[model samples]
Target: MSFLQPIALLGIALAATPILIHLLNLMRHRRESWAAMMFLIKAKENSSRMSKIRRWLTLLFRTLAICALSILLSRPMASDESSLINFSNQKPEVLMLVIDRSSSMQKKFLGSSKTLLRRGLEEFEQFSKSWPESKLVVIETVFSETVILDEIETLFSREMEDFFGPTDSGGNLPFTINKGLNWLEDAEIGHVQILVISDQQESNWKIRENEQLIRNIKDKIDSKEGLWKLRFLKLESAEINNFSLVCKTYREETDKFHPTLLITGNQKNTQSLAVKINVNGKLSNLKCRFFPPSTTWTPAISLSDQPPKGWIKISLPEDSFSKDNDYFFTYGNQEMLKVGIACKDEHTRKFITAVCNLDPERIFLNETFSLKSKKLKENDLLMIQGFSSPEEDSQILKFIKAGGRVVNFPDFDGNNKPQTFQNWNAIESASKNDFFQISEWNRNQGIFANTANGRELALPYLKILQRKIPKEGETLAFYKDGESFFRRKTIGQGVVYSFSTLPNRDWSNLGEGFVLVPLLIRIFDESSESPALKLLECGESASLEYNELTPITGNPNQKPSVNAGIYKELGKFFAFNRKTSESQDEMLNQEEMKKTMSSNHILWSEARANSLSFERAEIWNLFLIIMLLFLLGEGLLGLPAANFSFGAKRQ
Candidate 1:
């Protein structure tokens, strides 16, 4: 049991008023002696006692009424396990508000500029103003973790101005809700109410995959046994006809730059949208027509004459959501790398050159060395197909430290086995007739971007007669037998890659198939673009190897740089936009929400909800009813004498 207004309990002293009045009346009365009065006093002694009992009964009813009224005025809230005697006054309530400040909450109505977040904050301000005595703690859903904005004491001090500011990040409701519940547990307060305010986005609240987590949270609240209250304020939605540029993939085709864009629209009727592009500082526009449940438009932009190397900007017409309308891309002209291959056999040298796919002028074989000046250059990529002695190893290590990429293929020459190399040891080979299949590869990385079309990569059928493993490098691809086939090592500013087997028909089938061409091309492309360019979402942070990034727009001191634009550091360009997942329009309906939450939790629509509707166990009306019943009992007990007098007169 708890009291919302405990000061009214002082009225309980009025219960003694009836007893004081009765005692004072007894003292004020003086006994007048008379012959007839003395005789009647003795005979009617039993009657006097009965009349005193009736008076005492009336006084008891009046005192009980006063006590009930006092409790009613105190606004006591009692649980099912609580009684009047068990009521306490120390359970001060802490109102914790978890609000969603993501950009998805910026959807506004058709005729008004007010958004869901704006209206929801207005309703929350009104509700919080009504509870000036309660301590408020506010947590906003952020990109990293749940951020505590306003502490409990600040709300009590009447210093709150804005409930939530504009944000560029998307909401993460599950993380924030769990954080609030944990804070309540640590606080150990008697009365707590968690008020969640959001538009009920499925991207925010759908945790069907985390069923056990949801069950655990439900059990925690039930363990409190009515000490905690969970309530939700669901915001309403209006008409939405939003179009967004999901993403764009840029590539070099022939001597020109080619770009393909993926655009998604969510609307009821067909709409015309203007698409703008700035390629190599040349501006152009394309008109797109879309109709939807979900409609995707794929448009290709091709440059006939090779445009000058520069940045590209794609944009869409602004609507209710302006965060996802723009995109940025950077392109560079191909600079053929000078590559050299050191191999003992002619077949291996030709195979390496075929995989590289570079022009003949830039591709050279080290086996045809005719002079001492024909050694590997510092800026050239060196593919070593065989190893000779410790002196050769020393020269390769020195070349790697000078900012060069080294792709080493295992060598099995006369008297020098693969295990003779330092820092590496080769065990006995597996069954000779058995095959090795790639089991795992990094998907998020661009190296294997086109490797997998489904759940698994359709790799070439290859059988390995010999395999060598590295001792110091991260494995990028693994075989079915849990052996590494490809590994990467970093030395100074350069990188080294070790391929367990050479791309030869005698050792493996990977050389005879179609996987070697693009794989080699991508490696060259990735090597040329050292420290690859990334397109990040707005809420994420960037860590660069060089401190040369300058903000072209927006404040650099402000984290996350909510404004979408292009940033340049040194000669490289980066693109940042709002989180792509926020473009989804899926939401949970009322019945779905009911199934997702526990029975102890309550949900209300912010469109028609108020603060007083969720008050705990309102017993003031019950106390008023009890007071009226006691009043009726007092009147009925005092009426017995009148009935007896009427009966005697009638007789």
Candidate 2:
């Protein structure tokens, strides 16, 4: 038993007050030895013992009443299954079950072979059986669709198996619950008991991001306080040792293709594991080690140039979750990178062309055309100085969506009215004898990142004499004055990188080629290689523009949007992997749950990985009834003895 208001239990001390008052009454009286009193005392002596028994009974009832009142105020709850059965005498009209069926639910329970989703389903099945009269309604996370089961036995039918099966997608608890609430209002459900079963993964809940939705749910539940009851069954266990693998980036060389992999885990000590590498049907193994205190490991694999266009599959030994253990990748035919220049300034165009032709063997300067030309789609990377009209903006945006990278510099002609992307503000000139210097940049994983051998770039030493500020985007590098030096925005499968200053001596020291060469070369390589191979999150394949997608690995019948594997569409292969957010280990704690729910009347319980049955039901009403009965008994026992005497004189 648990008390919602445990502090009220302190009132139980008031029960002793009845005994204290009775003793005080006895002390107030003194024995009188008068002869007239002796006769009356002797006449009542035979019935005095019976009167003493009645007085004690009345005191007992008063003490019980006080104790019952204290317990009632405390709001005691019964947690066992049997106790729940007796407490829920008044059954609900509807039993609504909300289940979280994300990939994390497939994790095994501690010390048990069954997964959290399996345990939750068994518990809900038993609960539905307990309330046979109530209609059963289920809301699953994958689709957030409500399924009404007319017969409780149909829950285990073959038709329902697919609905409860595992999914590769992540769960959205707030959205699913909101959908359930809307259904309740639309169906006009009365007297509902909502049971939410989940592992309470924090990423799935997104409590902070969905505050307004939670508030709306609280308001609707508050309006139907008596008609609705909310219960949460949290399935949780200690963090298990697990590893996740992903393909961060890959580079193509003359003789081989190198694929860079990132491995992350929760182990506290150094460990080594073998990874299986499959290159176009040929399998091989490689070993990698992870050091303590650092949970990330990056390993690169080299494949010969024999098969220019094929696929690669990297797999790790199964750990806690098998879904994230394997990563898929595909490569396409190699070709020279095409660079497009769209600038009105002669110096800027020559400078960019010089940079692109530095490695003439691998780079090709296709053309210097206007932004409105259809040839924009023919190049892999576009260097644009300004947008002259909305048509140019639409053409550039279309190029970006079709997997073309763009680098935008301030307009020398001062025409900056781009409709799709961020536009540049007026150019700002530096003060005399001072220049703008870069202070911070994201060097972890962007074009400004460290060199291949892990050497930092010379961005801190670069200075700018004049610059323009981008309106808005993700700022990758910041200037000393807190202005954006470099910003990036993602569109479709491609990216646009905006630089505040030009690459000439008049603008800044970027003409020295220290930062300009590597930055432009990296963007060029990324644009040339990234489009040939694509890595997407699960459930995102449905948005592909291809008319048909055929599975290349895993179950051939499973749709690419519902599973992780390699699929071919329009002669190109795309790899689908689980969302990185599912690998997070954080969960909702008790304090967070209380603050988000904001209702003390709700009942919640936690179930261990092995232990099965758990439920909470408020028994405060039972205590209230007991208290009333005790008070009634006390009143009857406190009445005078003459009230029970017969009316003999009237007869």
Candidate 3:
């Protein structure tokens, strides 16, 4: 037996109190053999012996009663075998049904047309009906509103059907359990029985230990004193084969927009798949093949010369689950890069102008401006040819905070001071003889990410005439003397790149090397667009910064709504769908789940097509009953023998 309140067992020492008292009573009496009245003494001794034996029996009963009471107060719970003990007299005080309405639950398995969620709910209904007096609380998902069932007949109604309807949102098992714990805390109930019905997908159930979410659940249940029983009814299928489509990206080639779709599945050999596109109220089909057992095939659809003016809907072949089969996309015209040069020096201006207006493939539209120019847009890249003071013009810092990138180059005019938010610090200038060579560099990131033949190509064999030591940020390129050559700092939505030396030959040989062209282009690209893709899961909220667009299918712009589809917001597009990781068919078995959850109060059952079951049974109340029986026995033993015989005829 496990004791919930092990500290209460210390009261068992009180059982020795009855034995000690009985011994003291015996000590108080003395055996005196007097010959004055022999017959009287003998008769008295016999009566005294009988009285002493009765007192001893009563003491034993009281001690046993005390021990039983201590055990009961300690809240002793029986071992695993106690589940076999039938407690039909006891009823669940709180019945909680936590259902998973993720997209994966809609998969129809063999031998049944109903979805996994449907079958699981039907099994729960059957079990709940057996205990008609149970108070039910339904939690569909972590995001779902908590519902209290008023009537038993309402379990299978149309309203409940919608509550358990299909959804494209993914499920977080730990978060759902936390919600249930919150409800259980406020509920004024006795014994709680929570039924969690889910497909038990590994992506959802395999909560990481470091997450602290599952830890909260374990701690809450452990502290409940075994008042609640958590049962997971894992629904499984016979065969697992699924396919999904992911909207990857949009690429414009030859002035035409093409939408790329990544088709992924676990088919055995090769399977033919259909790609459907609905545009201008006309439907078109394209065929593709999946070379399987885990293969990804990417196919692109080129739009016509006119392009799609309205929202476009693309769909793949329908499978058992259609939540992730469709995608939405809208094409906006290509945006141009705006560049602002803050350099007034004629020599520096000439170099910057030559780089910005390079050829027929010209990308950046350049304009000359001061640091306080009103023409500077938030998205424009402000390239300062010489060092600028953040204190001289507060507008420079304000422009950066408003989503503007700054590229600062050293002018060596002795007016240089470290910016407030920039990570680097200004130190003593390098000596003339102490020229530093390239030591370390982060070639795989930032501006040098795609440098051609980066590993084989050697950096310019040049020495810095003067440079400053960087105090922070990633050292993209370092000098042999432990000074940073180039550093990148991220502040809010914008970035600042600091070069240790000037761009001209007088300070460094970087401009004469192959790094200049790609460096400028990468900076322009970073300024024009965000590098991160805005892929979202269903039911997630859009950020306030992005311009919300209306979906074509429904009025998704309604207040307080979570709808899934493609959306074009401001400079980027959002492709929201079910998380691709949740599509894996892997699941945790019963034993595996027990170890993962690490809670003794948890019970698990696999409610297959035939039967439903509950595993763990509580035995705390049984200990209480045993204690009461012991008390009754002590009461009967404490009564005198003459009192019991008074009811009978006097003999």
Candidate 4:
């Protein structure tokens, strides 16, 4: 047992004076007698002893109340003293808070109340304020890892303020928690209290070791006089349904644009869902039935018409928390992705150059010499006109991964291998229509105005190269006829587009004028511009605006194994990750994460129940104390009550 203020014991010394005075009065009255009232004195004598006993009991009760009140004021408590210190107002205490800041937290599940974080943070803040001068250490966990946010003994310190920011929204949250536990070994204090505030979605990570580790930590803290607290907040959407346009891709192989969308319907109806989309300001409604009942849906919508400044949105009905419902993504400007065609044949070079439209500077036609792969920046999109198999080239794969598009056009002069895609019989018989060519009407009626009477444009396709494409997702476009005319597949976290046909009209006339510009532009520019905070997609990732993490093993020139993941080497691309990828793997995009997270957003208040584990013994001990007090009271009054009953019966 310990008290916040031990000096309050002086009150106990003062309590003794009253009891001493009462004893003196009783002794002085023992020899006093008056003969004038013998009969009256005899009558009062019987009740006098009873009255004195009652007075003593009343005084004792009053004294007990004063002592109890004083102790409560001093805040006496029993807890571990593992973290002892010599500082003023400081007892032994350890408090650890685990905060989840994954991208999903972007959803305001707390209604218009407090945010998940705001609620936990406020509890800690208020507790610290009351304690005033006590030690506090904080650890932030996301995706099974922990970052020591800050530690302080003073309530509102600068370190505490600086440490508050967006949570890490990533893969396998248990790992983040494990990281936090391991890092906590550095705590300079002894007694510790572990508090976890999150959605409690670790069932998928139900490893026995993890479960045991959590219990072990709690037992240590409890044994040493520390507390364990857990506040779980469910992330089910309550008042709002949101739709996000995650990402767009261009399969240079197929010469098509594929856009992915993530929709969440947390409405009263858990059956079916529907959503509407807007592309470059053009609107269309899409519906999903409970025939495939699901709470969340990920759908890919293809655009037939190439909107110059591609703007797209997927939206559900708006709610008071409007940031999540409707999302906007701008397809980067519709411009030709410059291509460098390397071939020795002049005719093949000219044909490939004519198939694209960009500033003359973006076009490189050559029967020329070698180019250093590294210097080939910005306009790195390349097409090998000759029938060369780049299957062995990992560098080309890296190019596509970096967002640079690539197209391989076979040479018509007999040097190129057309058979690499598929048989010619397949190309001769296939469905040739634009993305909007559903229900017989060409969706690009206005955009393809120049070629209303002509056949569909030529999109070079190829049989998917297995090694070049990672097994991340599905293959969106396939071959036409026999040999694959055009195909799009993701490669090593990059995109690869392949075309099996030549660029000249010798194969197809779709390469005519305006269609060529839009087609070429679609393949080169795969993503949208800087979008509003609310328009971010689910698996789509936005990186920090500043350098935070970097890789060492891959980039040869950089220094090895940095202690803190920060450095100039982190370059510019570190702040991007997809919370919406099909795999649900975590990405590290914290730069643009919001900092002004507030509490008035979470619904459940922690002033009620915020405990991780409860010891049965402590509770039973409290009950035993109350029972013992009851028995002592009975013993103190047992004789008097018996005598009163006997006297009443005789009367």
Candidate 5:
């Protein structure tokens, strides 16, 4: 048996008090000699044994009463085996179901046909039957909205299908739980049972990064000791052989279209796989070999003489997880990428202009302009090298909100006045005879990612003599001394990149054009009109303010936020896919889970795919009844017994 308040068990020491008092009373009796007293004592000797028996029984009952009271106060819980008889009495007044409908939950166990999500729903449906009077409320991951159900049967009805249906989005377990707690606090429900059904994927939990959130949740649960109970129905599978595909980026040439794909799986050996390609409804297949530990693959598709604006679908062989097996992408005709340069230093401006104009085909429309001019909205990307005035800062912000990317270089004029967009610390330079070298970066993604053919960038070869540090943002690349080389901040829909060093001979060798050219080109491509709208993570498309969106692929009636598909709004096409984190194979182990949810009020249990039994129940009422019964027995034994004669009555 477990306890909600184990400190109350210290009261069990009171049980020995009764026995100690009985021993003291016996020792207090002194021997007395008298003719009359001796005769009376002899007459009652036969009944002395029976009186002694009743006295001992009274003491035993008193001790048991104290023991039961202690156990009752501790709030003991019984396991399934012991709680079978008391299951009906364990109904809670409020039942809040926090379900994780992330993409990973769609995976099925090895050799099992039912998905983890389906198993969770079935388990909850069966358990809710035992609490027929509970007020059911659900919080799903996709929307994280508090849904009040009229009855438990409504959970399975067609009207509530959207809440329980599959979703390609990743789950925010902490945020969803917080939302449920907020609703419960507003409703002022006393007795609540929060049942969280999830696969315990680490990406969904994010235990380390969300320390503050977890602390707040723990404090809230601790404040309401007996009023709330938290339980987890973890549906964990043993096998980890799932294959996931991700479309990192796509390129279009004269007669061929290349789509860069990332394939990640848990298998440890090399294997051959077949990928199905669907280009505007025409189906074909390609054979590829997968090597363990290597996850990059680039495939080229032959394009016909059709219009460049179309959609492509890539599908892998069905594996343990079906949701991540397919990837959707939409392509469009290439347009000239416009770039605006606002640099105070002549050398910095010339270097950047040269790199932007390196493409011989004139794919880039590079223009030198001042930030004071109100022509920022037309450009796809803006490169600023120095501080700007208040008016220019406001215009830059508005441009960023309208989906314009910006790259900020350090100010060489020592003008450190605060700007509205971002703040930077004083410039720091390397010591004499020493230089700062790039030590680490995210090579799998972002501007400095590997080439389409899986070649690393030349960031490590660069040496930095001077740098500036941003006050706040995510560090994309780090120097040898743990300083940030590149930082990124996402403002609205656009991103701002901050480079610590300038692309000049004085600051670093970034002007060598190997790293600078590709970096600028990737950033320029990302700022295009179609790339951002063409591919998006699930749940992001729902936030768009588009008035009308027609389905181009998948179910026409389904919401884009809940499923992966392609849609068209106005004249632009958008493709929604599951978040890449959902494809990760890391799961929370038992130790980590215990550390994350460390509270007496919370209880977690592992569940098999087909198990339907409730694992735990609070049996404090059983101890309460036991304590009352023991007290009643003690009272009865303390009462005086009536004297009786077997043969004759004394008159």
Candidate 6:
């Protein structure tokens, strides 16, 4: 607690204030002869007033002295930390860079030579050259518009690796920069710098917390005598039209593709663009279509030849973010999604097994399956002819949770004794109106638009006397009256699809249809969407990929990354397949939701919605200012009560 001045404590000698007043209670003066008495009384009154003034001055001086003393003891300070800590001389600063590859960055003002990121990186490189041994810590951002996870070596230096290309087409403009700055914890003072190279898109740059964190770090560095510089390399060019594809996916169960293609650009209206698709590197098809900007275009993609290879690519012949004009992904193979059915009983299991093919080894027969975490490997759709036992029911639920899928017929026949497992009783309906079916209208739909050898479905006739829908039932096949024939629901991650009618000739003849295999394959495809599946609808710009085998890679923790090529036809709107990731058993707490739902999940969804909204911090600051104003108003209101009442309002 060193102080600039220690002598200020001497002012405490004035603390005798009130004591001095009491010690010398002056005797009241008596008037003597006329003139002398009057003068003496007046002198005494003057002395009394003077003493009162001295007492107040003494009290004020003592208080001031105490405050000064505290100040002297406290040793109030401003830090030289920022500079002193930088004492140990260091080499050039290393920066981790994230450059923007948005189409806007590609706008050319002078000529083809300069684009946003190109220029920004150039400036960054130049800046680094000025410092000795200044290294790049880590740099990974889409350039030219493609998302690339740089090999670890790429973080070293250009001499260590040389990989440069335009970035992929999509990056949500707003960023989460915490991942960038967090790595520099306790680095050599002034030895590291975070250089995020971007064009400073207004949408991306306004994260106040990011700025505050940087400022705090700078302040701390200053206190430690360390050098901290927030160097901004603003890269900009004239904004231009940007048409990007946001999303694309295929529904295997339906043998269909539904892509939500988004286009954002200067041109708000629809424009004709050619979409080129290659199936497994083989040139497949090219079509011209009109796409409107800033809207989702659900497009249908079909192949006339062998179904587009698992790997598909879509390209827009033109767009600024050209590096990402196409994307590639392989859908689960139809063969991989089938379950070979081989059940025990003739009345229950045998009958259902015939409904769809499942192997004895792969079948969901008993409870031991999921204790091992082996979700029923419904490489294909599961076919359960008979109702499962208590053990089977529990296993089925676990399988569903583990991602096994099944389409089954629940037997509730009077002739066929229904199966009962603990909580669920499969009761057959004798009512003539009980049977529900998938009408011919649904069967004949042009669902396989792009498939060359696509299945032409024939309805299955399953009249198994079955139980009513469960509380968690899903009506996949419904009757005209809206009752379910096929009630599919999740038992966990596994899918439990039940049908009331049996599969054999005695029941409805649906099991012996040409479409049976195809329909079953479709179910498997639908269920496998449980992990890393992409969906796209009709009229949407979609890219198809056939990179590998069935069973899309299920890396739950590995970031689900989609590479949309230079155009909007590629992987877009890389939405993390949320349904697959969330726990089916985890219910959204409505009480918690209600607290937020008054504003319609405003804060919850507003974050991902990418909608333009006011910053909450600014709102809170305004609230603080309002509170301060209120206090100021209260203080002002009291001014009128004082002796110096603000000149009374003219009566």
lDDT of 6: 0.41
Q: What is the lDDT of candidate 2?
A: 0.75
Ranking by lDDT: 5, 2, 3, 1, 6, 4
RMSD (Å) of each candidate, 1 decimal: 10.1, 10.8, 11.9, 16.4, 8.6, 16.9
* Candidate 3 colliding pairs: none
What's the CA error at residue 383 for candidate 6, in Å? Answer: 20
Model 1 C-alpha lDDT versus the unseen true structure: 0.62
- As for lDDT, the candidate ahead, 1 or 4, is 1
Model-by-model lDDT, in order?
A: 0.62, 0.75, 0.63, 0.40, 0.77, 0.41
User: Which model scores highest in TM-score?
Assistant: 5
- Select the stronger candidate by TM-score from 2 and 6: 2
Candidate 1 least-lDDT 10 residues: 154-163
RMSD of 3: 11.9
Q: What does candidate 3's lDDT look like per residue over 270-318, in tens digits?
A: 8787788765335778787766643344445555654434345678777
Question: Residue pairs in steric clash, candidate 2?
Answer: none
lDDT, candidate 6, at 540: 14
Clashes of 5: 0
Tens digits of per-residue lDDT, candidate 6, 397-475, equal: 5555565666555444332333331123345455455654555223211221112222334443444333444323544
Name the regions of candidate 2 deviating beyond 4 angstroms: 1-237, 253-255, 268-272, 293-308, 345-351, 412-418, 423-495, 504-519, 529-532, 541-548, 569-572, 580-614, 618-651
lDDT of 1 at 576: 58
- By summed lDDT, which 10 consecutive residues of candidate 4 come out lowest? 558-567
List the candidate numbers ranked by TM-score, top first: 5, 2, 1, 3, 4, 6
Judge candidate 4 at residue 289 and give its lDDT: 50
Model 1, TM vs. native: 0.57
Candidate 2, position 3, lDDT: 68
Clashes of each: 0, 0, 0, 52, 0, 94
